[model samples]
Target: MPPPGQDPRWETMGLVHDYLAAEFPLINKTLSLAKVNTYGLIYEWTGTNSSLKPYILAAHQDVVPVNPETVSTWTHPPYSGFFDGESIWGRGASDDKASLTAIMLTLETLIQKDWTPERTIVLAFGFDEEASGIYGAKYLGKALEETYGRDAFAFIVDEGGGFKDVYETIFATPGVAEKGHADIKLEVTSPGGHSSVPPVHTTIGYLASLITEFEKNPYPVELARDTVPYDNLVCMAAHSRDIPRSLKRAIFRSGHSNAALHRFEKDFVLQDKFYSSLVGTTQAVDIISGGVKSNALPESAFAIINHRINTLSFVNETAARDTQTITSLAESLGLTLKAFGEDVIPESFYATSHCSSQSSSTSSSKGHIELSLAFNHELEPAPRTPTSGKESKPWDFLSGTIKATYYSHRAQGIKTETTATDGDNVDFDPRNVDGNTDTKYYWNLTRHIFRYNHKNAAYGSEIATGVHTVNENIPLDHYLEIIRFFTTLNNECR
Candidate 1:
């Protein structure tokens, strides 16, 4: 696969589409198929009732490229679809191909059975999701909006969260919200000179200090009620028996008492890095560059700090906090500051903030720091899908379908009949995705977007599954279960 912003492997993507067309002839013949931007696919299965809004089942065709260095370490060759009687081992087996194949197989089976839908079903398959979805989903989103108008779809199901065991209880978490994204570039400039005649601090030194300041002050994590993380906690507390008595009590009491919430955050949330990141904005200095030669003093140094903004916050808030973090240190170092194209610490402020005893010659030696958005890709948090009340009928229906699929998969071939009820062991919860998905582009198409694939994530280690790494594989039964889930969902849709 090509890197982000570069032209994708169009020929490679075409082969997958061609295979789909040949493999699922029934679906290809029945549905209205159109190719967007040469690779992105859209297939619409018209329904009997035009009054009801259509819903989308979305997946991506691309998978992260396999590293050649790790080929020898894989249990089977990365590209080889080796089925060891129980699981299929390949590069795209688990991350996304499973979902894509399941959706296609489900539709084909439904078509073979001569079943027509009351509500329309749309399938959106993008070609470059792994590379930030610029080449694929972006154009596809524009085409979809132009054809269907904004918010025309009832709901959209994309690849995301799945069922997993949390504290001994089985919970299915569908990502109803996704965090925002930003990449802030910090660049510092100084007078270049011989290394022997360098000033007290060079451009690289100032950049290091700024980075330290950012790490010193992280975004505070708060456990607010009605939020996705809090809701997940509530479900765990209500059903999971492995949680400690004190923590469980705190989680239950947190709804009504601020003191309990604080205790829970301090005791549980902060103690667990994963939970803390879920509730707070996260920052990481991902890229840095400095001097080219050892003999010369560096004239400039830059670093890009990536941020996954919290759902409750906006991009502007994150930028503001970044500016605030290094302002004092930059001023103390006699450096002028500019952030997001606005003058933060002007020349006058820099002159006044510096020590008066400093000579005029030293004033000319001061450098300037500039902060700006990197790559021009700044996105606000996605709108949270409604999970309750009258507007959440789609969510309710999906939840029921998930429960039914779980019960049926386990009770297959049994003589006894069973019904999915609230008392059943399974719990449905809404969760927030820390990273963005292709659904990021489809936000305008549907407010009821669910990032989910009904796969069980409790089977193996993340590395063993090879989602974006080596030894990628998926259990055969799990893949079949996904097909069953999608089939049941299509038939049960009202």
Candidate 2:
């Protein structure tokens, strides 16, 4: 993967493409393939019936680059593709390559069995997802929209949350929505001078104060009804075995009572930082830089605060909150404030106020502070995927498929059925992705978007398995189960 704004190096990706072509000859000959931006792969298997809408299985071909300093800490080489009779160890083993490989193998198997479908199946593989899919899915999305028009597909499945044991029950979590994203860049400028003659506060000092103010006030957490997190909690309360009785009752009542909802949020959600972050817009000052010399005062200082906006909020709202956060401090420091190119505190107003004050006699204003979007990428929260009622047939079908996959993989001699009805083997729930994925670009192609991979989260320690970190690996049985899930989905789709 490349850095945030840099172009990806495609030498290794080209090799992977060649390897796929050589490995899946039947799929290559049967399906139509197109390369978008010379790297993004799109494969389409046209169905016999043109009346039914096609569905897409999306995956990324790239993985986060491994750190060279951590190479020695790995049990196996990051790129080895070594299978120690249990798991496959490599960089992209679990994050994405697993899904891509599963889709291909599923298609190849179906082709070998001479199975023809009434509904078409499309596979979209982007190469730069680790860097926000700028050069990959962005073009693939356009090509897909041009070919099929908007809302052409029945649904889209991308790599995301999978099945995990929660409260002693196996729950399959398919991401029904994703949070919004923004990076706010805060910059402060002041007069440079000798350290001995420095003013009461320097540029760095003012920036620190602004950052402190931001931390002092955070977005409030609310358990709004109909949200993904709320729905997930309801499912947990309804299906999980070991939830506290009182908490379960509160979760049930939360659907109608605002008092009960806030109580649940206070007692449960707010108690955990992880849960609170998912419910509210989160902020983190990831990057900061200031002085170049110690002998002289710093002329300018800046910091980039990353935000994952809640599903209920928008980019403008977040920016407004940030502007309000530091306005008072900026005014007290006699600094002009310009937020997102709009002047909040004008130089003349501060100068006039300073002159009018009895204690302050200076007519000239102090330096200014500017707030702007760090990157041009500002995404609104994704449209929620319907998970119930008549319009949610696609979601029901997916949930049934997940249950069937889970049962058949574990129990022998059990026939796998893919009906959109309740079953006894496993439970399903809608969840939200805290971060964005390649699905961000394909939103217009399908209203029913599911971010899920059918891997069991209980296979190993999540941090130990190391997605985007050291010792990344996937169990061989888990890989086979993913292929099984895809095969069943393709077979069951009408």
> What C-alpha lDDT does candidate 1 achieve relative to the native structure?
0.87
Per-model CA lDDT versus the true structure: 0.87, 0.88
Return model 2's CA RMSD, one decimal.
3.4
Candidate 1 per-residue lDDT over residues 1-494, each given as its tens digit: 45333544467887898899899999989999988878899999999999999999999999998888999999988888899987899999987999999999999998999999999999999988887888789888999999999999999999998787677667888999999999999999999999988889988999999999999999889878888889889988888857788878888998899998898899899999999999999999999999989989999999999999899999999999999999998888889999999998887663442557765445532889999999777889999999999899989988999888888887785321222445547788799999888999999998899999987765333435767888889878778878989999999997
Misplaced by over 4 Å in model 1 are 1-8, 359-362, 413-424, 459-463
Backbone clash pairs for candidate 2 read none
Report the C-alpha lDDT of model 2 over 1-494, residue by residue, as the tens digit: 35323544576778989989999999999999998888899999999999999999999999999999999999999999999987899999999999999999999888999998899999999988888898889999999999999999999999998887777677899999999999999999999988989899999999999999999998889878888888889999999877889989999988888998888899999998988988999999999999999989999999999999999999999999999999998988888999999999887775554568533445666789999999878899999999988889999999989977887776654322221224434788789889999999999998899999887774234335688889899877778889989988999999
Q: Which candidate is the best by lDDT?
A: 2
Give stretches of model 2 more than 4 Å off: 1-8, 357-362, 413-424, 459-463
TM-score of each: 0.94, 0.94
Could you give me the TM-score of model 2 versus the true structure? Answer: 0.94
